[model samples]
Target chain A: MALAIKELLAVLKDKKGRIVLIMPPILQLFLFGYAASFDLNDIPVAVYNQDQGADSRELVARVIGSPHFHLYADIDHEQQISSLINNKNVLIVLHLGPNFSANLAKGPGTSAQVIIDGRNSNTALLVQGYLSTIVSDFNVDWAKRNGKPPPLASLKLRAWFNSNMVSRWFIVPGIVGLLTFIITTIVTSLSVAREREAGTFDQLLVTPMRPVEILIGKSFPGVLIGSLEGSFILLMAIYWFDIPLRGSLGALYIGMFLFILSAVGIGLMISSLAVTQQQGMLGAFLFMVPAVILSGFATPIANMPQVVQWLTYADPLRYFLIILRGVFLEGDNSSILMHYYWPMAVIAIVTLSLAAWLFRHRMN
Target chain B: MSPFAKRFMRLRGLIRKESLQILRDPSSIAIAFVMPVVLLLLFGYGVSLDAKDIRLALVVEQPDAQTSSLTSAFHHSTYFKSITFHTIQPAERALVTHVVDGIVWLRSDFSARLLNHGDAPIGVFVNGVDANQARITQGYIQGVWQTWLQAYARQQGHDLAIPVRLEPRIWFNAAVRSTDFLVPGLIALIMTLTGAMLTSMVVAREWERGTMEALMVTPIRIWEITVGKLLPYFILGMGGMLLSVAMALWLFNVPLRGSFLVLSLASALYMMVALGMGLLISTVARSQFVAGQIALVATFLPAFILSGFIFEISSMPAPVQVMTHLIPARYFVAILQTVFMAGDIWPVLLTNAAALLVMMVIFLGLARHKTRKRLD
Candidate 1:
């Protein structure tokens, strides 16, 4: 046991290996902390108030008062809005019809129009929410002026698991997905490249260890290191970021185990094929970028075009994110686990098998 | 033969060798062409700002034709797919619990009030947790309801005055397909990653592998060795640029508004800046691992974040915007946008090109100074 501890310490003391294990997670934490944000501010908006009435002017004033929105211009023509939306300049267009005030004074079925650019669905959705609240508040003011009973009794809002909507709540779980890919891919790629560079790969092949054992051993460090980094990020999320982990720890670990296995498998395959460290790095990046984009990290899978959504099934990060979000945010039970388990299991098997096959073939 | 011609021929040979090395690697070829298409497709469809499948609850104080019509509109609108009509008390409970995004209340005298006053206001209560999405949803509801009112007015034998008609013409991206804008930026990002990360490690890897010591002993001039080492990566970077441009024009159908000659020249100049930055990092670090890390932090991250490739720099904090001036990708992105969208505005192109040239000269000079003959 003492000898085993010494061996572990020796491995840890190796500067390159230690950096290879430590740097990716630290870099990822810093990047994710700074870059990944959901708070939508400085939203561009256009107003087209045709009412030309006192009511229309008041409505415009109210909208401009909100800090979340920035009114770009008062467009006179409808065609201008299309250009603005297309160029991503204005996200929402408000068209207040003639007699808008007259209709509101008469009150019960009056209406106005707002056209939204749907290209960036997430931002559009949030803008929609903000508009509704503004209008609701306006309704209350209008009711008080007319001496009408308040519209209904009262309003109450309860946000579920992530009550605060802290960016960290969503982001910390996602780090598990991002870190898994970064650490596993970099470590495995570097390990294989190191062997090739040192000319020790051929010597290793002469040993009795089968290609599968060698593949497993090489991949083991990556998976272990990825999980360790993931755990560290998870702890930071809970302790430093103050995001609550409502789900069972056991379940999170199990999902992480499967995610690491699939990620390491992919890294091992790239490493086996890459002849140099540069190629290994490029190869890993080529795979990693697409994997993250398709994983629904920055966007929603359901919003994707049908064909692209179908392609996400092949991505392991997609399944892992669903499990992570579901378990951490919803505290969902085994049913959610069941939904993603088979997909993750299939990915692990396929990727590991491919890595094993490539390891043996590349050796020959 | 001139001395310059002799040096140029040697450099050309080095460039050819580098191109062959890149072509031999199938992964590099795939990354050059296939990765951009994959990114375009993914971003085109996956990144959207529209909301769908919103759950809604409706409450009516009075059971009348007018109240029912308003409730039905909420149910049938494409923006909201699932809706339930409930009593006022139950709908209030649903809104607080976030089981539904919004609640619409139809007053007891809805039809009577509308018939008497020409129009009546229906109350809508929205949860404000995601304020932006709520605003957009409100806009959608208002737009749809106004359209309904216009049609109703036409049926009533009253000619509705078209209050305002907006005529919008999108200048560059007529279809406003996000892919058209994103593909060019992706090219910038890919070049940064490949040129900087790959070349930065090359000299450093040589030092790490003990190959630089042997190469240094040869009677090669400093400029020749630096240019020769860079020649191969410059060719590879050009190949990546072409692959991305071809994908943008052919697969995505984005127009090449500017002259191809200008685009190629600008891209080639930008490659020098990128490759020189890498070589400088590699020479200074002299260790492949450290060089890779430095390249990613200094080059790749800034290119993606601060270059206005993904996020608008104008919206960033004042300090961040000031910091972005140092990132090379910012100039590259401006050049690419001007070429693709604005038909190669000469003034913009000239300023960007000069900036890139200055950066290249600085980096290349630093690289030359750092590539020492000593093994220590």
Candidate 2:
């Protein structure tokens, strides 16, 4: 316990260490949480209504009135459409034809071109969906105000967990997993490598301390730092972001402790192999980039191919992310989260034992 | 030899020594050489935003021929893989538990209400844990319903009316393949990793090992030393960039529509900025751990998050959007996507290349200013 405390204090004593341990959780949480959003509201749109009729005017009004779109500038001619999109002044152009309402009144349908700037296809797809929903709603409202029945088939949509479908609720919880993994692995990997590079490894090894004690001393600081960072983000999630914590905090911390163990184990394993601190840092970074990519933090694992989906089963971050989201948003029970937790527990055991074995083997 | 030639010879010697050290360090070689390919394979193959085969639960309160036919319409869709629940309760539970991404509920009077009221409302309860997926899944479900209605109408010899026909023509990417755009943006990310994150540690390691103090005592100019140290990493970063381009073209089959000269010029400019940022961090940090942390916090995260690579910059809040203008990767990503997909559009390329050149000059000047003979 005393040795572990000493190791922890050494990390916290330095000014740079303090900044790395304390500053990033707050900075990244605020920056990434706000910046990473797919919900595009008030998307700038340019409208061109050549129709001099009331129906076309009402359609344009409905497009502007909806919270999803904002009227940037009205275009008078067809030549202005491409220019607006090219200049990125507008994401979509609503071009109402001269015979828009005339065709609606007649049997055949009228055409309105929603020309989207597909440079960012995700944004274009979402904009198209929003425009469609608004137009269909207006069509129903117009039909009902005329005392006629609405469309033949309608969909009553309900989005569970996030009713308004806010992107922050999903993104904020994910930062908890990502931030902890980054800090823990980077810190612990540097701990022993720093000593080794400074030539203090020989001095420390000469002392009466056993290999297991040294292993615990070196590795537990990472677990402690990881949990501290985890809690910091968790607090920010609940209070700063107002994302409620529905599950038991005890369950959340237990899962986090196990995750930190696995992360620290990986770091220690890297530290054991590295001859220099630079090597340790680079190894940690190389591991982290791929771990994050495969973890499904930004994209869904379901979308990955079948072989890659099978590969995700071995990633600790993938399982922990499932637990984090499940606990935070879905209020999942302990038994349900254990389905994810046991795999992390197994990883922790396997990696820590491997590190310990490597530590003992390197001692001679 | 003239003074300038002597300086050039000294810089070459320094570059050779640094290259040897990097080669001796297995981890450095792995990071500069092997890590890029591993990351590219993972990102190109493993990560995707395209949604397919969404798991859905279908709840039919009444089992009849028409309802069975409607459910079969859903099952036949390439987009959905569905499981059947007899009632709404189990399906609702499945949605909450995430056993399925969405649930479709047909009320007991679905057919009867369609005949009597000329309409029937189907309940679509989606798990919006991932809002983008939830939104896309909602569209797919609605499309399936519309198609089934059209087919049923055709079987009955009638036409279903869709009031305003929307013609959505996607430009730049005709098929809208996510990989085409993502692979280009990823090249920027890989360059950032190698140039900024990896280069910072090499200089900081010299400082930590006390070799930097010894070098300062030698007859090397600060600019010469800076250029010498940056030269090898620049080659490594460009090599990584070339590897990414090759993988993008051959492995991912993404077309390189623009001139190769344009792509290489933009990459070189962006890489200089990345290296300069790394050297600046090393000078300030003077410790490998701190330098690594600073490089990650200052360069890597910002490049990944603020570069408009994954998230659109226009959608970010006002201050964050302004902050993105400060990041050098934003320009690189723009140049890359433009060059890869839209071909050599001079306006986009020249504008972004000009921005990258300005940032390269700024960062390199800062790094040179920071490199001093005396150790603080």
Candidate 3:
């Protein structure tokens, strides 16, 4: 054990090895914290108060008042509003009716319309929330002015899974997927590339280690490291970010283990095909981008076109995401375990087998 | 001989070398062409906003006509395909236990109240944790409610006042295909990968192989060497640009409304900036590993994420928005989108072109300074 530790320390002492182990996780953490944000804020908003009355003006004020919104322009004409949205100058347009104040004065049943650009649905949804809150507040104020008891109609929103809507809740679990992609894919790619660069890859082929053994040995460290990073991030998410881990710990780990295996397999495949480290890196990126996007992390798989949705069935990250969201948020273990376990298992076998085949072919 | 002619000759040699290198690597060439197409297909088919097969629990407090009518709406809507109608208690239990996404509470005297008031507010209890999904569900529910309201208003001998009607004409992407949005960004990403990653490593690899030292002993001037190294990548970048454009047109069918001339000019300018960035990174990073890493972080990530390709840059926090300005892809993506979808918006095109030119000059200047031969 002591000899192993000494050898490991010696390996780590190399600047390249130390940087290889440390920099990816640290840089990834930086990206997770600063770059990845789903909570839409400061979304450009354009307003056209056709009413130009007290109600219209008040509506405008309410929109501008919210921290989530930034009023870019207050246009007079509807055409200008359309042009702005089309130009991508604004994400939302607030068109107040001519009878805005009159409707408010009349009472509780009155309604106002909000037009949103749904090109980016996530931002549009947040904008809609802001719009609803403003309307609800307006309803409250109008009730107070009329000296009538606040309308009996009330909407009590009960947010399930993540009640606070802290992005960390979703992002931290997704990081398991993201980290697996970044670390396993990048590390394995670099390992294969490094061996090639040093002319040691050819030397290794004549040794006792079979192609499968070599591929496994090179990829296993990355999978272990990826899972470790995932666990560390998950811990930070729970302790620091206050994201709840509602599901069974055993189930989450199992899911994570499978996810790492598939991810590492993908990395190994890219590395085998690449002649140089740079090719490996670029090839890894080519795979990683599509994998991440199609993982249903940034967008919903169900909402994708039918063909796209069917394609997601092959994406291991898709199953992993479902498992992550299920176990972490809902604490529902049975359905996820039963449904996703087989898919993950299948992916692991398929990817690992392909990687081994590719590795042997490349070596030959 | 004129300096221009001599520089041109060196550049031509460099271009030839770069082309040969690219042709030799089948994997990189395959990735350069197929990866974008794969991404577009995946994004187009796999990522969607319309939710289906949502697990819903309908809670009917009373066994009445209004409750039945409301429950029927839930059943009828294609968005909520799988629903389990249960008592309020069971529905609430299911919600907390994560079995169902939402529970609809139907009040007592629902039918009578509806008849008297013409319309009644139905309580919709949504799990707000998945805000985007919740919002989409809420919109679908609201549409159902509006249809009911219209019917109720007509029965009451009232013409429902249509206040604000927005005829949303989604230009460029009439279908608002996410693939359309993604394809343009993919073009930017591919160019960055080829121009920055491939170019940066090539020069650094030459240095590592000791070929650079051998070349240094030749009559080739430092400027000639630098320009020569850049020339092949410039053409390679253009080739990547053509591949992306062809994919966008043939595969994704994204409309190119802007002039091809403008697209070519902007792409050429953007390629220079991308190539210049690669040269600078290669000059700074002595090793292939470091050069690749630097290129990935500085160019690839920013191009994909911060370039308004996948995420909206305008919606990002002030600091991030400011940082995005430094990413060359942001300017290029804007130019491409404008050129492709909205036709030639000259002012936007000109401003972006100017930014790319500035970035190119700065990157080339830095590359020149870094790659200058030094006497110890």
Model number with the top TM-score:
2
In model 3, the Cα lDDT at residue A241 comes to 58
Question: Model-by-model lDDT, in order?
Answer: 0.68, 0.84, 0.70
Using lDDT as the measure, the top candidate is 2
DockQ, per model, reads: 0.16, 0.69, 0.33
What does candidate 3's lDDT look like per residue over B50-94, in tens digits?
A: 467676787666767555655676788777854555467778787
Pitting candidate 2 against candidate 3, the one with the higher DockQ is 2
lDDT of 1 at B123: 70
Q: Using alpha carbons, what is the TM-score of model 1?
A: 0.76
Error of 1 at A113 (Å): 13
Instruction: Indicate the DockQ of the complex predicted as candidate 2.
Output: 0.69
Winning candidate number (DockQ): 2
DockQ for model 3 equals 0.33
Which sequence of candidate numbers ranks them by DockQ, best first?
2, 3, 1
B359 in model 1: Cα distance from truth in Å? 3.9
Once fitted onto the true fold, the runs of candidate 2 whose alpha carbons sit more than 4 angstroms away are A146-149, A202-208, B373-376
Score chain A of each prediction against the true chain A by TM-score and list the results.
0.75, 0.95, 0.78
Cα lDDT for residue B284, candidate 2: 85
